[model samples]
Target: MEKERSSLEEMLDAARKQFLEEDLTTLDFKIEELESRLAFSVTTEGGDVCAFCPTYCVA
Candidate 1:
């Protein structure tokens, strides 16, 4: 993020594009909210499931 007067806007093109060009208009919160994910594959070398999803959530 970069400073412009007061609010911070996303600077990277790749990251900014994900927001559909909507620049930052508010403060960013640090609290977690309704986190969720899914795992459909695994890494054979580590035999570890992909990130975040519970074991049962994996395929």
Candidate 2:
């Protein structure tokens, strides 16, 4: 059976693809903005999440 990817993994994959596709100042992101965003998934902290949970978010 195929193992499901965690929320962090999903987020990382999306972020990687986005950064790769976007061409902005290369490594030194010319057009970068630091803003608060709600994270539907996060890396393991207390423990790994085997399934999705509600009301859990990060900003």
Candidate 3:
């Protein structure tokens, strides 16, 4: 489980980097649409919002 979580985090980090380096307007719109569909908000801090799904939530 730890290995899988690490791999997933790595993938999400890569995707977030790619999104930030590319066309941001379109990507932000797409992310917003996905968030609406998923019914969850990506975690934000210090004005930086993550562009991936919210999978780091603790219960």
Candidate number with greatest TM-score:
3
- Most accurate candidate by lDDT: 3
Error of 3 at 7 (Å): 0.1
lDDT of 2 by residue, 1-59 (tens): 12355777888999998988765445445323221121324444535452355544342
Q: Can you give the lDDT of residue 35 in candidate 3? A: 71
lDDT by residue for model 1 (2-59), tens: 3662354434655668575444322222111222112234443554556554553223
Query: Which is superior by lDDT, 1 or 3?
Result: 3
lDDT of 3 by residue, 1-59 (tens): 99999999999999999887787878888999987965554433334444453345432
List candidate 1 stretches off by more than 4 Å: 1-11, 21-59
Query: Each candidate's TM vs. the true structure?
Result: 0.16, 0.30, 0.38
Please list the residue runs of candidate 2 whose C-alpha ends up more than 4 Å from where it truly belongs after superposition. Answer: 1-5, 24-59
- In order of lDDT, best first, we have 3, 2, 1
Kindly give the stretch of ten consecutive residues in candidate 1 with the minimal lDDT sum: 30-39
Consecutive 10-residue window with the lowest summed lDDT within model 3: 42-51
